[model samples]
Target: MTHRTTTGTAAPESGAAVPAVSRTDLPGGIRVLTERVPGVRSVALGIWIAIGSRDENPDQAGAAHYLEHLLFKGTGRRTATGIAEEMDAVGGELNAFTAKEHTCYYAHVLDEDMPMALDVLADVVTNAELAHTDVELERGVVLEEIAMRDDDPEDLLGELFDETLFDEHPLGLPIVGSEESIRGMSRDTLFDFWRGEYTTPRMVVAAAGNLDHAHVADLAAKALTDAASRFPTGVPVGPRSGASGLLRPRRALALRSDDSEQSHLMLGVPGLNRHDPRRTVLSVLNSALGGGLSSRLFQEVRERRGLAYQVYSSHASYADAGTLSVYAGCAPERLGEVVGVVRDVLAGVAADGLTEAEVVRAKGSMRGGLVLGMEDTASRMNRLGRSELDHGRQRSVAESLERIDAVTPEQVSALAAELLDVPLTAAVVGPYDDESELPGALQDLA
Candidate 1:
């Protein structure tokens, strides 16, 4: 998913003719959310499940991602080829991904073909066969993906960073399990994980773009009736909750030596969760620090020094824990200077926040990004689905904007002081034999 700053302007007063959003909890714990957007012929539908890599035990590592692959191979009614043919007939898109806290299987198609899309999605999510033959075939594909990740310097650095920061927590593990785990996994093991985790209570169905709430609800009802009957009755489970206090700063830097001209390193610290009110403040601060071309990190690291071609800062928030990280890929010999500038900038921010002018510009950038992101049906649908699954309710575009608007420079400064004051954890990948051989400043990282 693309990283977006979701803050916008105030909404129109009540009684205005605006897009309509509706929610319903059908029988058997399946909840549905739909938005009726005017003047578009397309529809975006998503089935979001509240199970991800973090939910797995050490033995079940990668089961969620594996299931994502196998489900598209074939369902009870549609063969893998048949599924592809059906999607092509309608000129539709069908894809899915697994994250740390959840997985989403989504499709985009013309509104007229909504019924077919819903039916196919229901069939795959609810009735996947998970056959032994399919399992063996996908195993090789997953191994190849792992190999590909290892071959990329930035990707490998990212994995090392997470592992080092999160330590022994499940959040520390890679979403795609190691080669040993993937190769040793059995068909029965995946089947069992699927049966327990893929319940209706753990799912949300969200739709947007030229859709009628009642009509889409009916279509969904008919499609999922059989699957609903199979599910046990209870209140739907909410999104991933609670913080992993285990995500403390690492004492020793994690180094992965690679034969590359440029060194990829991330300097990060633990941050707030999704429910934290400070998240809004964090967004504003992140935009000013490294969210765009004009950000502090980009301007100082690239424009002033001309040390590297790419430099940026990013923030990731899970249920309870989060991270603020700065990434820079520079020549192996220039790594020390790049790391020094970043450390100094971060220290300055922690000591004293951004200027009033910087804060105003950052807020405007965030607001523009939020408004523009809502212009497309796909982004709108994603916002609805993710909000409902992660937050248990949806905030109106206006509401979200108001929160961002309410943020003060004081709030941002305080948040920076609290989060950035902690010791930094670093991950580096480049042409170096070991930590001892790295630059002097980087070697003492703690």
Candidate 2:
């Protein structure tokens, strides 16, 4: 196997200099990327797999997440308890999560323990012993998790909104498989998925904080040796791209009637994909609209009217499609007023965009958040992994801040006109029997 290396440093900022990032592509398509933080002793390392729930076939709804839990159950050299004990001995943290497009197994340890951390993480990802008992054990656990999500109004509302907006696309499916699918999943099916999708070419190793790029790459290469040898040489998978063939406003309203204390409502329209150049503009607009406490939704819906205790707008970008939505929880009787206020707020922004002052404040907020959030090693590692998986390139903090600063009011307005002025999709979870019992504003949206 051969190696290719590249290095780049970000432009310096005020207090601390920006860290330098480097990448090494090894034979068999495994890529390792690292960022060296100057004043930190802890290292955050992750093995990022490119397959996620969205990659699952219909019958395999929760296979990716199931694999996440099963990987921690046992591996070739360590039992689940042993894995926990070793990390605890080092006072380190080891965990993992499955997303729409990827899954990550990560650890945080003192820099000196990085080699041990990398080895354990690699073992968990590549050498899991997915026993039948473990599969059954985790199936019950995942089902309980789904039940927990159902019990949370906000969580259930998010799922409902995605279903309404994305229609029948896999992106609309819950990360946790439904009860039927979970019960039906067999051990062999999961093992096959793991062997097929968890290849070196579909993986990235990222580490940050008080680490050397070459040493980290060396550790990764050694740690992943067994897995790397199993596959023939291949090229790393490019970033996910292409249209999300979703029909907009597939259904205007999706409602789940529950006798809860408050009504949960989500209203939104189709949004730009992750690759859209206008995404930064959308970010700035989202900030001004609902990204923070001073955002328009908070001011109009909560501060002034006292309509609801919780109200905000958020946007999510996936590989091919995205969503921009507003969420508000209020008394069942007050759902109408809340909907009216949110609709008016979005309509006003769509019609007139944001003021120059709002845009400036949004940019400053974004810039500060970006810099401050990177104070931890975990955040830095996440940035490296997500950048490589999503765009196949690293974007520096300086470049990000510059892009945020460059967004003009005109650009934001143009995007808002394009994204927010369309037909809206709505999802409701509250004490309502059907659409007829809902407020007229929501019905009008439908």
Candidate 3:
């Protein structure tokens, strides 16, 4: 069986069938979202928390990510080694990640092992010991992580792009804070941040596999019973609502001299937010622009001219704002030619838009991506958690596919014009000693 919309009710936007999804708000304000998929013996469970890097203040910086590491270090009942051994004994995989807007601690295990997964997840998330020695040890690890990122040209360029594009906004900060920030982060500071942010209202537990919704709900409820009083009123905190103040877009050029063999560049403009109706159209537009080998940017910059070895287009959408960008990694000497070709392709698309054939191909690719992504329990669990957290409602797969099918060429063109007509921001990381050495096209873009 496929996934469902949720328990409260199915809000099917299309006549096609949908999975029997269930959502329950527990007595302590925890949200349980479950989808039962047949023929899958393994279950994927994730506890999604709304606190992420964007939720932190300047001083708090990487506290959210720090907590992710510390939680796995040890809990009240399980030492770090014990936690690892238990998961290994069950042959289950437990992992977690921190993002700009959320953090997730997830596990992939057999259906029968669901009890152990829930217990361990609840203990680590709610009752972590965050000992001082572990804090100091993990601090060194996070610093090495930051250092590793610094050594990667592409990763560094992306961080630089965000810093330049978003300016002072918290969204601009990297998921792993800087060396200075990580070095200064104290154990007490992280402990306090964890206590304040890890609330019932800010959390959601999601599972998908061959499991019953009511049973999963009960397991999660019992696992989290000790923390119930933390939410005395049992009032759901609801989705994040308010102005993110990310509207201010700083259009400029940023250069980070890496003395690398190739120049990595991203030229982009502000795009749509998560809730924008035209986001679907933007997806189609992105595909046609540079999403695949058949895309315009790839064809013009890599296929025909062979100006760059790699060239593509991508975009990111946050709650408040987003970005659409084209990336090209080429020889430093060929940087000018690469930038010119990419710019020309973008300008051409903005002026004339994509052909009907291109739009059709993009839509098909998008539809395939949507359907193929749900072939596993882990992906389905992620979809359930993210949809409930982001939109406050689960959109059915059929309905989503229908929306993609309905995106007309006119819709794509309009969105392209709206997003591409603005002044662009460019970020380059490579062997450039001074800004004057940049290509004329890149300088003009700047």
Candidate 4:
């Protein structure tokens, strides 16, 4: 079948060079995107699948991640050991990760080895054996992973926080399925999930570094030939969108008792979704509030009073929902003071917004971070895949920087006021057995 290709280049900033980006639509609705970077001897290739943990039914919890592990076990054409040895023989890296929204199987190799990299990745993603024995073996590994998460205070706290904020929503569930879910997951269930979700239209093959777009597209087409034949022709799936229906905090507090000396606390409110135009404003607000050492929370909670050893604020933007949260770890005895200070800081921001100078610094930080982060092929490859998957198109660096620079102090202040005013949801992981034992400020949240 004839394939249609389209190409474009990122707009370079003044006196700067940017990579040329291109896309190809192949048979079976598979999309291949490539970015050609100059002066790089290596290529970063990734097979990005849109299916993630949130897409699974309750019974299929953690199936996406479990399938990620099984895919590397072996394929029809190669043994697991052979897959490892081939990549290692060329000093290349092969790995995969599953997230709440997507999964990626990627490889980093010398540009001269792009063919082998593409072929290996395609084979693994499309032709996984998913043997019953492998499923059983991987089940134990996933259970151990869940145990590991439970053992870590901060990790457990994050899960608890999500549960408090999102309630019974799929987003609230742990990406690494619960211990019960993994044990009960049968081989047929996982195989069905793999077959249903890992389709050509749901996949994007992206590569960045020293390579030709046409060459990469051709290689991808050749590599996925047999796999494409199995699926019916379709258009690429659009970016995920839907109302999360999470308009308010489900609960005021979630606490997990752990006998740790330091307490981990995460207090947050729902923020904007990924498609919000004011995301730039929220980013600026987050930066001034807790993004760096100069951030308000850092100075107030750590530097001014020495109440906590580490403190920061962060935000997560999903397709239809997002969160703005602050996390601090400190001595168990200092939990009350830490919570008070964080509350005060957030209140102050909500009432007045960031200062003009703070907004300027935040914008500069955002711009610098954006440029410096793209210096590597891996980062570029990731950006290409995420942009295509998240927005269905590439956004130029110049455009992003412009958006950041255009954010004014007023915009940051307004966004801060709007988001921070929501009723707060809190999570704590420490030596507190119940809500009554928590600090007064935390108890007040409940």
Error of 4 at 319 (Å): 1.0
Candidate 2, residues 212-282, lDDT tens digits: the string is: 99998888888888888876677899899856655464438889988799999999988888988789999
Per-residue lDDT over 347-408 for candidate 3, one digit per residue giving the tens place of the 0 to 100 score = 88888888999999899989989999999999999998888778777788888988899999
- Per-candidate TM vs. native? 0.95, 0.96, 0.96, 0.97
lDDT at 380 for candidate 1? 85
Cα error, residue 322 of model 1, in Å, equals 0.7
Residue-level lDDT tens digits of model 4 in 1-446: 67898877444334323438888998878999999899999999999999999899998999999988999999999999999999999999999999899999999999999999999999999999999889989888988899999999999999899878888888888999899899999999999999999998898999999999999999999999887887666789989884655557443988999988889999999988888879888999999999998999999998999998889999998998999999999998899989889998999999998899999988999899999999999999999999889888887788889889999998888888888877799999999878899888988778
Better of 1 and 2 by lDDT: 2
Superposed Cα deviation of residue 14, candidate 3 (Å): 5.3
- CA lDDT for candidate 3: 0.87
What's the lDDT for residue 206 in model 4? 94
Query: Which ranges in model 2 have alpha carbons more than 4 Å from their true place?
Result: 9-19, 244-251
Which window of ten consecutive residues has the lowest lDDT sum in model 2?
A: 9-18
Query: What's the lDDT for residue 43 in model 3?
Result: 96
Query: Candidate 1 local accuracy as lDDT?
Result: 0.85
Better candidate number, 1 or 4, judged by TM-score: 4
Q: Per-residue lDDT for 419 in model 3?
A: 79
Q: Candidate 1 lDDT, tens digit per residue, 173-282?
A: 99999898899999988999998888887778889999877777777777778777776564678776665574665555889989988999898998888878689999
Candidate 3 residues lying further than 4 Å off, grouped into runs, are 1-8, 12-17, 242-245, 248-250
